[model samples]
Target: MSIDANKELVRRLVEAINRDDAAAFEALVAPEFLLRDAVVPTPRGPAGFREAAAVFHAAFPDFEETAEDVIAEGDKVVLRWTARGTHRGEFLGVAPTGRVIGFSGMAVFRVADGKFVESWQCHDRQGMLRQLERAAACEGGGGR
Candidate 1:
């Protein structure tokens, strides 16, 4: 596929995330695809990716993902995006604090045969933690 086509595929992936469409997500990913997130501390394959997405969806039912920009070269597509959602479930061992949070991240994807075969993502972990801390404060939970 061309660079434009790869970029479009990445865009659709982000859209699927915004909609929390697991089927769409699965369709775009290779069966053995690997996803590595800086905040997660480990690499996750297709099944693991699904589990992670499920946990995020359950935590933030109204999650929205916006792809700020995308750059494609060869079979690699790099995506910059921001995700906004309200915390309503456990996240990173933290209990629900009912706060809205927005975090930005950049992900590099390797596509093969029109499907994402691998991805490496780096997100604003400290920023997310700060937002959660602020939310906890609003809920009368002590400072972190």
Candidate 2:
């Protein structure tokens, strides 16, 4: 596919994630898709990808990621994004603090045949954890 096509594919996937459109998420990702990120523990396929999304939604019900930039070359697309959400549910064992959080990250996706085949992502996990920890402390609670 063309570079623009690859970028569009990624854009649609992000939109699907933000909208929590399960069908679109499933359709956009290949059945054998693999997501490599610090946050995902299991070896992931499309279903696993969906599960990861569920985890995020469970923690931040209104989670939204805005793409700041998207660049595509060959079959790979790189996206820089910022995400914000309210912590309303447990996340990775961290109790909900009802705090709004924001973080930035970047992801590189390998698209094949118009489907996401693989991805590698990096995010400000430590910063997020610190923010949550501070919130927890302020609330007279301890963080994990």
Candidate 3:
């Protein structure tokens, strides 16, 4: 596919993710797609990817993602994004603490035939952990 087409495909993928549209995500991801996440412990395939999204949706019911920047070259697209949400469900084995958190991340994706074939992602894991810690403390009626 052309570079523009690759970029468009990635754009739609991000839109689908932001909407928490599992079906749309499934359609856009190749069967062999590989997802490497910084926070999550496991590398994910399509099913795992879907499960990861479910985890995010469950933890942050009102999660929102904003794409700050995107650059495409050949079959690869790199994206920078920020996401914000409130903790309402379990995350990383922590109980719901109702903390609001935001984090920024970057992802590089390889698209083939308009489907995401592979992705490498890095995010502010330490920042997220700190937010969770503060929330837990608050929920425990302690001042940080």
Candidate 4:
């Protein structure tokens, strides 16, 4: 795929995430795909992305993802993004605190055969944890 096509694939991925559409992931991501640096270990391929999306959506149902930057070269595309939402469910063992929160992250994807073959992502887990802790403390629960 051309560089523009590769970048478009990444954009579609962001759209799928915003919609929380697992089927879209399944169609766009290769069966042998791998995602790294996520909150949890994802199984290979689109199933892993589906699982990862479910976890975050379960915790923040109203979350919206935005691609702040997208750049592509050859078969690689980089996307910087932010997700903002109100926490209404458990997250990594943290109970729901109805807290409004946001997290920023970046991901790099490698495309082959017009499908995402692999990707590495990095996000602000520590910042999110601290926010969750603050929410707990404010909601009459002592933070760990």
Tens digits of per-residue lDDT, candidate 2, 14-127, equal 898898878987788898888898786546677877787787888999999899999999999999999999999987778998999998999999999889999998899988
Better of 1 and 2 by lDDT: 2
What TM-score do all the candidates reach, one by one? 0.90, 0.93, 0.91, 0.94
Best by the lDDT measure: 4
Q: Which residue pairs come into collision in candidate 4?
A: none
Supply candidate 2's per-residue lDDT for 130.
82
**Residue 19's C-alpha lDDT in candidate 1?**
74
Candidate 4: lDDT of 17? 88
Candidate 4's error at 10, in angstroms? 1.0
Q: Candidate 1, residues 7-83: lDDT per residue as tens digits?
A: 99999888877776778877888887888875554335555666656667888888888999999999999999999
Q: After the best TM-score superposition of candidate 2, give how far the Cα of residue 93 lies from its true spot, in angstroms.
A: 2.0
lDDT of 3 by residue, 1-144 (tens): 888888777778778777888788778888888888866644455666676677788999988878888899888999999999899998888788888899989999998877888889898878987898888988898788
Q: How many steric clashes between backbone atoms does each model show?
A: 0, 0, 0, 0
Every candidate's lDDT: 0.82, 0.87, 0.83, 0.90
lDDT-wise, the better of 3 and 4 is: 4
TM-score between candidate 3 and the true structure: 0.91
